[model samples]
Target chain A: MRCIIRLTLLEMLKKKILYLTLALTAIFLIFYGIAMNYGYDSLRDAEPLMRIAVSGQFLSMGIYALGFIVSFLSIFASVGSISSEIEQGNYDAILSKPISRYEVVVGRYIGILLVLIPYATFFYLSIIGLNLYFGDGVVANIVTVNILKSLSVLYLLPTLLTSVGLLLSTYLSTMGAGVTLVILYFCGMVGGILEQIGHFITGEAKVVLTSIGITTSLVIPSDIVYRKASSILYTTSSGMNFSADNMLGASIQPSGLMLFYIGFYIIIMVVLSIRKFQIRDL
Target chain B: MMLETYNLTKQFNGKGGFKDVSLSVREGEVFSFLGKNGAGKSTFIRTLLGILYPTSGMGLMLGKPIGDVETRKKIGYLPELFQYHTWLTGYELLYNHGLLYKMKKNEIKARIDEVLKIVGLEGHEHKKIKQYSKGMKQRIGLGSAILSDPLLLFLDEPTSALDPLGRKQVRDIIFKLKNEGKTIFLNTHLLSEVELVSDRVAILDKGEMKKIGTMKELLHSPLMLSVGNCSEKIINELKKIDPLLERVGNDIKMSVERDNDLPKIADSVVKNDGLLYMMKRKENVLEELFINTVGEEDVR
Candidate 1:
């Protein structure tokens, strides 16, 4: 399994997708860097409160964008990790080894994550460093604890996407899994909207909408994770926003159980993937 | 026994997979599977390797139940038209294969050099698999299969994609592996390869093992005597030696399972005043046996 992990990581690096991802990330950072260097000058010159609001806005947006990039790369790395190889008859030699099916899938998953977590960390933290360095002390107003909290929550996003991607890869073709993941991504977005809808409605209608949101959350907790991470920015709040009160996962107050449930979702998907792949004809 | 299958069948599709394939291959011998396209040769190997589940019966590989990790560690496989991770360089592919077999890093490094040399892929290690030619790909595949120096090696069409030179290169490697006391289960359509290397051959036709025996047993050529000016007495003399001797066209053909019988037939032909135009043993006897077993239509 260690060999698989090392080989898979080496293959991913050789494909240079990681480099391309980093290049895209660097370009994104450079664009944001420019945006901060000049675009925030006027905001900084304004009242201090306005500057704080502007910095909060960019910080939240940057976290979401970074999360999306990491999630995309993680999915791409894993979506074809099993199904495509089975189609091409590549697993015969590997499975003939002295490793279990679970090891094959887990080794691959860890390989992708090993690359992903570090890349996500670098991108996630660099933007923070850049904002602090370039934003004329405006971005420093958000508590460091909040930034770290948000970053930690944001980290789960890709791991969750990769699990879902590998789960679908177990039974579906590479393209089929990719398409299904796209639909699930929409479900996650809709889940976020439903979570928002639960805030404004009341009575049985409120119960129904919240139930639907909860159902979607259980089915695909990735969107719930995104919302919960945003809520961490302002734990005292219930809505998803980049306000100073909710700038670092503070007030939106989703139960810790939901986060653990998301983590469990990752484990279940991976286990299911291994079981399915173990019995597949290829 | 290196491998023993008792009624091992994988006919889930009930269309093209093999059935009731029971055989025993002793250690350090080369056993070959000869069959036409879709004749269940690959199916048999795959089932034995546990890539495909058997619907019934049992298989024991290296005296352990099939698909056991301990037994797998003692086995190697080169799948038919197998695909390699193309982005991987040849050396990396072998190295990774070694890792899968749980070899240490330094052990894998040493084995990679040895395997690459054995497969005649010395300088090509650094090149990525995608850039390799078809023949090169096959050689690298062989390299990975032998990287662990497994006790039992299953090579399916190990030379199918190679050119003549590459084919001989593979044949030589198979010979060398056999000399090193590896039990090889080879699946190939090349009858000549079977004749040259296999100690035993199983001819599979339409998912059935139609015939199987030692190479001498399967290719036991029937003595063909081309004669003219033959008389009834000469025919009677030949018949005495081989009760089933038959005259076809201008010659008398009979199974001369013993070399001593050859002399008696020649003496009978001359003493009885029959002109022995030729008394030659048929070459490519395995080819003839294969065609006879599988039928001529499928061979073409």
Candidate 2:
């Protein structure tokens, strides 16, 4: 199993996609820092309350982009983890060893997370650092506890995405897995936006939109993760609870029960991936 | 027995995989599976190796039921059309494989040197697989399969990517491994290679086992003779020796069960005053057996 984990890490590190992702990440951080600086300078003369709110908005946008990039990277990195190896006949030699199929699935999941988690952590911290450093006096006084809690929640983004991506890889071709996971991610993103919009309106449509959001979260709790992370960061850091008017923040704080469910969701995905790959004929 | 299967079956949606394959490979024997493309040759190997679960029936490898993780430690496989990890140097691939086989770190290091030497890729081990040619990639794959010095090795078309020299090298390696008491299960459509190394052979066609026997039992050199006489007496004399002798044009082809039958045949034809143009045993006995067993149709 450790061999499998090592192999998976070696594969991920050697792939060109990792270098490209790092290069793009460096550039994204630079641009985000510059954007925050310009926005803070432009809003300097504005009312204090307004300046803080807008600064929070800038922070929310940066976090949103961070989550987006991390989630996609996790998906791209993992969707082909098993399926491509199977297709290319690479698994034949590895699996024929004394290792169990579950080890391959779990090892790869952990391996990908090993790289992605650190990457997501660095990327998450870089965004927060840029927002705090460039926002001057406008950024909120984010305590260490809030930062740690938000980082933990942010870590779930890749863990959850990697789980789902691996599950798909076990049962589908690489392209098929990639396409399905990407579409499901879009579904989660759209569902979150719809639920946010639902909070602002009143009628039968509002209930329908909220129900759709709840259902998509059940399918993939990706959107809920981001929302929960932001809810923790903003509500704790600025004593400003999420409202529908904050376009970039969570419209409604997800319940504590949802976090437990996401944990269960990731476990179930990992378990199912192992089961499917075990019975499968390679 | 190193490997045995009883009524084993694996099919895709109830078709296209070998069925009811019951065979046992003894220790220190080279058993070759002869089949055309899509003949379920690779499928059988995969099933026995536990890469694919059997739809029905059972198998034992190294005395454990198939799919047994512990049992796999003693087994090795080189899959047909295998695409190895091309990003790693050949040395790394073998080291990783040895680790998967649960070898100690020092054990792996020592085995890599021996494996590289056997596969004839000694100095090339430091180069990434992607930099190697197809034949070199195959050699590296063979190196990894034998890295653990497994008790049983399954090589599917092990020489498919090799040139004549490389193929000869593979054959030499197989011979060397066999000399050390390792059982080998080879899958190939190359009849000549099978004839050279196999103790026994099984022919599979369209997911069905058509014929199986010791190489000597399945193959027979039939004698062919060109007789210039058109007399019934000459035909009758030859018929006395081989009752089922076949006449094609002015030639008589008869299966020879023993080499001593050749002189008897010539004497019979000469005594009858038949002008004998030629008398020679036909070559490529395995090829003839294969064509006769599987028929003359192309593999789909």
By lDDT, the best candidate is: 2
**Candidate 2: where is the Cα deviation over 4 Å?**
A237-244, B222-281, B298-300
Q: After superposing candidate 1, which stretches have Cα over 4 Å from the reference?
A: A197-210, A233-251, B227-240, B243-250, B260-277, B295-300
> In candidate 2, which residue pairs clash?
none
lDDT of 2 at A151: 92
lDDT of 2 by residue, A1-282 (tens): 898889888887776667778899999888888888899988888998888778878888888999999999899988998999998888788888999889999899998998898898898899888877887677767767878898998888999999999999999999999999999999999998888889889999999999999999999999999999988877645576633255457969899999999999999999999999988888
Residue A236 of model 2: what lDDT? 48
User: What do the candidate models score in CA lDDT, each in turn?
Assistant: 0.82, 0.89
Model 1's TM-score against the true structure: 0.91
Q: Write the per-residue lDDT of candidate 2 for residues B184-269, one digit (tens) a residue.
A: 99999999899889999999988888898898798777888999884788888878888998998798898778887778878888
User: What's the CA error at residue B195 for candidate 1, in Å?
Assistant: 2.1
Fraction of true A-B contacts recovered by candidate 1: 0.70
TM-score chain B for all models.
Answer: 0.86, 0.86
